[model samples]
Target: MDRLTLRLPPDLVRRFDAAAAGRGGRSRFLRRLMEEAAQAPLPAPVAATPAGRTGKLTLRLAEADLALLEAEAAVLGLSRTQWSVALIRRRLQRRPQLTPPEAVAFIEVQRELRRIGVNINQIARAMNTAVLEGTVLDLEVAQLAAFGDEIRAHLTGLRAAFEGNLAYWSDGT
Candidate 1:
């Protein structure tokens, strides 16, 4: 690829030069900019790929704002650059508005899981009450225990569904 010279305003150039000195060489930063301009779409301000290294990409940010991004990134389980990438992706990506159909389905599933969990808990309580309050034959007790185990299996399935939904919406972040 041919290298092109970009004329920046004096202040911005000074900032970029200083930022480059803090991390690595200025050429590396320039190369990254060239790569991004080639790969990144004109509409979106962020890198299309998550964690596109832009530590040396100087944005005119207050030090406090930078610290806040770092803090938020730590909380979100990403580095500062990854967090910035996520912000960019959020801005540039034409977000798929959750379809009404999907929204309804998700809501229904959540409600059903809650209802089922409540029912399972209630049943467990009843079983406990039955065992503690009444003299239970071994066979009867075993049947109740088996039923409880079935309820537990169903709960596990609900948990799996919940996790799957979360992963599906996370968009590889």
Candidate 2:
């Protein structure tokens, strides 16, 4: 038999097979499975952004630029299609009045802070769960201290970037 075998969760397969067993004809169940398997995933296309108060901004990236995004998306365990949707969302929400350099720095700093905040929340949850479970480690307290340090570091970096010639874009446009 030129059958291509695949491994699926036994429980799920059992459920399907059981349901299919009640069918009068052998082809009915196999046909349903083939139909489901042959169907392609629904396309998740990027949403078109509406113009905001800022002037029109259009961007076209080279294939290599897209490759970089696809690579990053793969690393983050997200589909490239979903990653593009997120990128478009960020772009549309950006304050376009800011100059090019300011826009870049501002977005970077905001992302850094957001990441740090999320990390802090995760750490806090872990710490709380550990405590509830009566698990103690000498380094647990020290690790908890790092959350404040991370916040301070991000804020300091943002301040430094602001103080440096980063006030305006150097593109000299």
Candidate 3:
């Protein structure tokens, strides 16, 4: 492959490096962007829309605030407007917007909780059958108690995680 070089302003390079960090660095990031751009269709010229179809919004933000917004949006691979709209929609809907990592953690926790619930259900069923048939219960009380404790711990952790997510979002970070 042929090599190409371009000179960029220092500040722009810094911003690009920051954005490209943890995303396979500058070269890979630029390559991916170029590939995406090559595959994307060109935008058509703007057309007039019905008056009631959409609304326009304008806001004046401080430089620091704009920088923060740009950084957050960059981290998520979103445009500033897209990120802002998503944040607004999530707030309006009373839903927490989780990052990819957060979503995966939540999914794993939920799966573990479901597995524990299934085990508890099995224990309960076995005990119920034993009681109905007037047979000795083979399960130990300590085992059931342990499961209960485990569930409580898991629930506590889940609650903490949810509260942390809420606080992080609400704090404008």
**Estimated TM-score for each candidate:** 0.27, 0.33, 0.53
Preferred candidate (TM-score higher): 1 or 3: 3
Show model 1 residue runs off by greater than 4 Å.
Answer: 1-136
- At residue 31, candidate 1 shows an lDDT of 74
lDDT (Cα atoms) of all candidates against the true structure: 0.66, 0.64, 0.81
What are the clashing pairs of model 1?
Answer: none
**What TM-score does structure 1 among the candidates reach?**
0.27
RMSD, every candidate, angstroms: 14.5, 20.0, 14.5
> Which stretches in model 2 have alpha-carbon errors above 4 Å?
1-98, 132-136, 164-173
Over all chains combined, what TM-score does candidate 2 have?
0.33
Clashing pairs in 2: none
Clashes of each: 0, 0, 0
Q: Give the deviation of candidate 1 from the true structure as CA RMSD.
A: 14.5
Give the C-alpha lDDT of model 1: 0.66
| Number of the top-ranking candidate, with lDDT as the measure | 3
- What are the runs in model 3 whose C-alpha is more than 4 Å off? 1-64, 73-82, 131-139, 171-173
**What lDDT score is found at residue 169 in candidate 3?**
57
Candidate 2 local Cα displacement, residue 103, angstroms: 1.7
